[model samples]
Target: MQALTSSFVSRSLVPTTPRRHRVRPLSVAPMTVCIDQSRKEKVVVIMGSTGTGKSRLSVDLATRFSAEIINSDKMQFYKGLEITTNQITIPEKCGVPHHLLGELPVDGPELTASEFRSLASGSISDMTSRGKLPIIAGGSNSYIHALLVEHFDPETNPFSKPLIPIELRYDLKYMS
Candidate 1:
């Protein structure tokens, strides 16, 4: 029995043991990875109070980056109020594509933050998907807040469901 055990141990330590397969080092360079053309664009949200030149700054930045502009201001959505709302000028919007600017009527129904968030998200998605940067420019505090912050706790506030719809609560909306 002792000799049998010794023979088994000797067999386990034999030099003819088969080796496991090893992974070959990757030869491809990291920089060679192709970037998706759809991801070339980004969304830049510019927010400020009235008369803070948000529109102008957005236009300038969009021009420099060859991006499209999306209006986030509530009043700027109405047409025929460009001077009153200080909306983007026609010349400023010439080369760059502008969305949701002067698209609604002055007497049109008021829009909730939830509605704005949906529209904004869709516009941003469309622009970014097409490899174009989407710049959100506006003076509305709530509009900026909705775009930049997350949600309020449902447990903390029982009325949270009614206070603001689920679609309205975004991660960035709670950041600020």
Candidate 2:
């Protein structure tokens, strides 16, 4: 039997016009979240386990709402490991801007939840300031929790100390 060559395969399978990947709405009923799109400060976060299509959903939402995507996946922060970490590709973004996705160096130090919160908050504020919606997507629950639950105001708490003797910190393991 004759083996098919690269030329034969390309000729047989490749379409004459390059086809773009189509984004389809999920068949399942949509979950409700309280988001006032009219409010510029409000952000949409897509959280789920790995391989649950958080990136896909974020891309779709970003495109629909003229928003930008901010990746919250810790593993996807560092450069490389695209396939292993399932980092979103440029084509998949469909001209939507993404922040904090594959932006860190491979050898960079490990990011703490606080750091992630800071980065994500900055991205959110920047997008909101410009009247663009901010869509955060990732599987990192701890990071998402930090971004959402923990409110840090330097102006309000100038000393940056706990209000009481007991620290008001997030215990993720206990919560999880």
Candidate 3:
């Protein structure tokens, strides 16, 4: 349970499974052509209030878009705080490649915002370069917001538009 999106469906709700050993690399085909670094890659950042199914939506979308999941939950990154953290179980992930989940030890020093930015940005760039969609998700709305939208002024974004209509925001209604 985490941030829930209006479009979230329950069945594909993915959680992580604990791994006793190392995680193997996914069997994905290499890209034959190079992607231009100048172009921004598509990013899916799932954000909402806590216990709203954000993680579930992320896994569902990741599977739908063949995207990789990256954890932005600050608490879930630690090694020994599993119970307190409410991390996704590995089996629940359904074999999708998840990054930065339980990445550090419980006693490890807290990760600074700058450090997280570096790690998340690096992972996104790497994933995009390989032609996979990068899904950034977690219950930490502030952290996720900082990583995705803080640096840019939305008003100045030329491409920013009302992808989701204002009417849809209410009851998520649509016409046939």
Candidate 4:
């Protein structure tokens, strides 16, 4: 019985005959669109450690590229934490559009990576849709990673295997 089973398995693994190959003629022509580099908006994320002039560089680049600035520092999002957070100055913002900066109250509870990711992603999409470059400036490495890196899905918790908070979806929308 064992021998019979082995022989059957071996026979099953082999092809009965030589395989025939067929080549299909290609008919569809490739289409290309000429894009204007100037019109193509890009997202530039400036990230580093504290006091590294991340904001300054972002502002300068935004000014040169006609881009909008999105604040990525976790602390800089709160109002009245300017000095402590080293938030961008009004002069630096310089009439350039800024998003998610000083929007939350300082006393407000800590915002999670999920929350920040959502807000930043939204700002990026809005700016890009309007044909403006999105410049993400901040010193928070984790916040930057949340934006640029692919991590676990926000919807399903790996450990819990349960549905993630609905807010996570809201936050992820901005990520794209």
Instruction: Please give the RMSD of candidate 2 to the true structure.
Output: 13.9
Give the C-alpha lDDT of model 2: 0.63
- lDDT (CA) per prediction: 0.59, 0.63, 0.60, 0.60
Q: What lDDT does candidate 4 reach at residue 29?
A: 12
Model 4 C-alpha lDDT per residue in residues 2-72, reported as the tens digit of each score: 45225423443234555574322111111111123344334555556665455655565566566888887
16 in model 4: Cα distance from truth in Å? 79
Candidate 3, residues 45-153, lDDT tens digits: the string is 6655555555666777677666898888888888877678777788778788888888887777887655676688788778877888877777665455446443423
Q: Candidate 1 has what TM-score?
A: 0.61
- Candidates 1 and 3 compared by lDDT, better number: 3
TM-score of model 4 vs. true structure: 0.61
Worst 10 residues of 1 by lDDT: 25-34
TM-scores of the candidates in the order shown: 0.61, 0.64, 0.64, 0.61
Candidate 4 clashing pairs, residues 3+ apart or interchain: 118-171, 121-174, 122-174
Quote the lDDT for 14 in model 4: 38
Between prediction 1 and prediction 2, the one with superior TM-score is 2
Count of clashes, each model:
11, 0, 9, 3
User: Which residue runs does candidate 2 get wrong by more than 4 Å?
Assistant: 1-40, 151-176
